[model samples]
Target chain A: MTDLYESQRAMRAMRRAAIQRGVVAILDVGTSKVACLILRFDGTEHVLAGDGIGAMAGQTKFRVIGAATTRSRGVELGESCAIQETERAIRTAVQAAQKMANVRVDHVIACLSGGQPRSYGLAGTVLVDGDVVREHDVARALASCEVPDIGPGREVLHAQPVNFALDHRSGLIDPRGQIGQRLACDMHMLTADTAVLENLIYCLKRCDLELAGLASSAYVSGMSALVEDEQELGAACIDMGGGTTGLSIFIKKHMIYADAVRLGGDHVTQDISKGLQVSMSVAERIKTFHGGVVATGMDDRDLIEVGGETGDWEHDRRTVSRAELIGIMRPRVEEILEEVRARLDAAGFEYLPSQQIVLTGGASQIPGLDGLAPKILGQGVRIGRPLRVQGLPQATTGAAFASAVGLCLFAAHPQDEWWDFEMPIDHGAARSFKRAVRWFRDNW
Target chain B: MRPMKDPAPSRMAYRMNRLMLTPRFRLFLRYGLPVLLIVAGVSIWASDEARRDALAERVAELRRQVEERPEFMVRMMVVETGSPEIEAEVRDILPVDFPVSSFDLELDTLREAVEEIDAVASASVQIRGGGVLAVTVVERVPVAVWRRATGLVLVDAEGHRVQPLDARADRLDLPLILGAGAGAEVAEALEIIEAAAPVTERFRALRRMGERRWDVLLDRDQIIMLPEDDAVTAMKRVMALDHAQDLLARDIVAIDFRNPRRPVLRLSDAAMQENLTTRTRVYEAVVE
Candidate 1:
């Protein structure tokens, strides 16, 4: 745990250094594709002191200079399975982006969509050290939280203080400088499998990129796809990626719970391949062109050629109705949505004030998923796309790039984490030395 | 089925592409490498002393070819002088062969050399049309003739010697000045001669007395010694005395106006003797 903490701190410092360099690359190592977006910080000169922290947030300060996406290889469910192959894929995407941006980026902020993310809610309380609660008290309160046993091979990805309470008044955003007997903080800590993170790190290292920060793709997708009102009034974002369906719950602009089901668009493609007796690539094409849920009579009449290269004449000229393609794609998508619904129900997402569910990612582009999602995942289910960022190419402004775009925003202004605050014990020796001096002075 | 090739780059290719994209390396490849190559090539070619010397010799030969072109060649010299003697003197002093390149001519130094001639006051040298080296000289006008103990020489008003004279009578139109250092004050001598114009008929020459004052010698052996300060004014005073009193016509052989307040005149021998005899006769008659 301490090792991971130190590594996380190192990563945080690296992120600061990368931002100082004014150029950082956003790498989304998804299951189906690896997308690299090079962002150049244009400076915060136009961000008026307090104005930009509102609706626009920090997204105005950076512009996407280059973007490239390549078909992922040797990665399963967002975990790097084959080291060299994944490195090659990352190199291809990064090289293309570097070519486009005409700059060499040394630091990269990457997102992972798999690794079995688990969220833990922890509440810690500490007595106020002085008459008024100070920043150190908030740090002490956060540090006092009981770390749950996240298992032997999992590491904390994010530990954010979601709420602060001063004495009896709960729901305080910041408890510092408030007169209170006790300061309490509710922190949301997300931990993921350590092996998955190590694999991703190794791949990035092979590509000559420094891991400045690593985030769960589900959290970042929520940051990008969920509207401000939805995030503030409570909502759930389901990122139906190629290899995993990730869901994150947000309330008061803070992600309180995040989980991913190891099932996504790739599974649907697999299902189509199996049901229609076509190649995986061809099935993917058919799915993208004609795949949908909640099929109508018109889909039954429309036919798609699911051809093959086999020498057999009938096999080469095989065709399937659009309704048949939908019949093959809908069940898998429904199973992924049902799994996401189960994860949200277990997370108590229904208790939030708003039950807005936003579905995004490459898989969410299925034609009739929006019409079919509310039935399984409950009401307020809308297909969501990533927010428009400056200098983004027209071709990349689709639902598939939600996490990639969110990584850009996350790189700009990351939410405060537990490690951002200095540990109170860091100043222990100095404080003791001063105490010794004060004791001598009082006696003399 | 022919297997589909992997779209991913090989590790070597990827590393090479990244190395090429490094901004510093790219800039070096684009600009620094070419400059370095050219410099290295030239240095290697020039490393031998013989090669360096050959290159220098070739450059000099090229320069010589350009300089010796017909357009820049000066075929002959033209001296514009007031007299043929002066022109011949100038041509003899400058001993340059004909058909020399103008680039080989130092015009400023040649002009200085030409102006050093006694008869030449100022000169300018230039290469003009038809490949002619044109030397234009302004000849000094000899204002007076000065007779030195060594010889007679024509001197200008500013007292610069122009040429030698064979005899005093050879330039009678010019007033003759004599004595050491008289050439330096020819201007003052000319002014005094102008003041004594009324007695010009008797004026023989003006001699510098003590190299400070002037002594005017007239043809009848009359001599006027003038004061050093305002010698021209004293000459003018003597002229005024001659106009009013016919002073030059008298038997006075020398008039001393060195002290202008007191004029002293020395008469000739017969005039003095007749004056003494006349005085004696008048005394004897008075006794009877």
Candidate 2:
């Protein structure tokens, strides 16, 4: 546990040094596309470390100087399946972006969508040793939370404090300098498969780039897609990508739940290819240009030519009605939405103050999805695009680039994590367990 | 009948347990509070002027502590390639105190200051071992002495003023130039003086005429008018003629070489009257 804390602190220090040097790269390794964006920090102001609550603090400090994307290979379901192919693809994207920006970057902050994330909420309280609450008391309260056995192959990605309480008063954002007998804390922890993380680190090492930071794509996408009010209240951002559908729940401007379904837009494309007997590339083209979820009577008359390149004349050309194309796409999209709804239900998302569900990503571009989403995923459903960032090219300002833009925001103003604090280490193991139990008792 | 009691507390306990197990609540306290505290602290620090000033002062104090370490102290400064007077002038111009921290010294600014001195042509400053701030300067050498109305000023090859001389004999090795714009034409004058080395003992001064051409003055009230375009070659031709014909010893007042194709000589008044008498006597003899 201390090893993890130490490494996290070291990584934060490295990130600060990189930012001070005035350039950092943001890499988004997704299922369908791998994108690299080089950001140049003008170094006008020193970004205060550990300041996580302010959203617009570092907004104008950085600008995208270079952006490049290439078709992802050897990656399936948002995880790298072939090391060498993914390395080659990453090199191509990074080199192209560096050439465009005319700057070489050695530090990178990467985001990924796989690893089967699990969310856990833990609470703890500590009796105030002083008349007024202080930072150490808050740290003690956080440390008193019960550490669950997240299993051997999993690692914690994000552990953030979402709520606080002082004595009888609950939902206190900050209890410091306030008179309270006991201080309580509610923390949210997200863990992912360790193997996936190790693979990513190894790949970065092979590419000769330092891994300064890492974030869950689902969490960052919610950060970019959801409005400020939506995040403050409660909302869920479902990012429909090529091979994975990432889901993240945000409340009080913090991600409380994150999960990914192994099915995404590529499944729909495969359905089209099998249904119309067309090549995968041609199916993708048809899906992007003519696909829709909700069909109308007018769609029946619209015919799309499904061309083939086989030597046979009969197989070279074929035609399908737009309605039939919709028929092939609607079911798969519905399945993805259903899976997302199930995951949200499991997370008890409906109990939150707001239930706004935002659908964003490449697959969310299907026509009529906004009309059909609420029917399957319940009310208050909307299609979302990534928030606009300064200096982003016209091609990258779309729903598909949510994670990339969010990564930029995350890199500029990262939320404080567990390792950022100085944990108390004087207590013996047995006494610490007892203190944990007692703190839990007082909070309950 | 006993099972009809409200299960509200139990239900609340179950909900609390489930909430505690979720990722959101755990992350909120663990990561979010520090962020909030830091933001609050930073905003407070930034907004409060007095506190910000105090923080800046503390940072500056810490930086000074590091900079004033023994290894970084400049114990002495050494000046190279200058006379004692020039070295003293350089030291006065440089803005550094002895035993000062090297980081506090701006080397480029110091170099510029040293170059601003009248005698310094170029200066280079570097920090060498043994706590030495070594400054190497190349001082300009005076090539000619210009006799201006105010005083005699020493001028370098590029016609830059080096210093003022109390007397012309103080720098007898340098050639003397006269007139208002003579300092700007020092290079050409020096070249002409070198070409007239044979007659240099008889040469007195070279004056700039109308800021275009030169009038070479000799010891015996004789003047050589030189053309502007090929003044060096013309001076060389005059020197060759003087060497062959002892032109300075002849009864001539001026040698005009403004037009290289036509060289003219103006004889003295006595010499001209003697020539007229001799010509009249020859005409009378021819008539008889």
The top-ranked prediction according to DockQ is 1
Model 2: CA > 4 A from native: A43-60, A427-444, B1-288
Residue A77 of model 1 has an lDDT of 92
What tens-digit string does per-residue lDDT give for candidate 2 at A223-334? Answer: 8899999999999999999989999999888888899999999899999999998888899999999999999999999999888776667876778999999999999999
Give every collision pair in model 1: B202-B219
Model 1, A1-444: lDDT tens digits are 567768888998898888778889999999999999999986666554443113122334888999999999889998989988889889999999988998889999999998999999999999887679887888889889999999899989999999999889998876767798989899999999999999999999988899999999999999999999999999999999999989999999999999999999999999998998888998888888878887889887888888887778988798888888888888888889888888889999889999999999999999888789989988898999999999999888899999999999889878888887778763467888866776888699
Query: lDDT by residue for model 1 over B90-206, one digit each (tens)?
Result: 898886888899899999988888988998989999999889999999999999999988899999988999999998888989998989989999989999999988877778999
Residue A130 displacement in candidate 1 (angstroms): 8.0
lDDT of 1: 0.89
True contacts kept of 1: 0.90
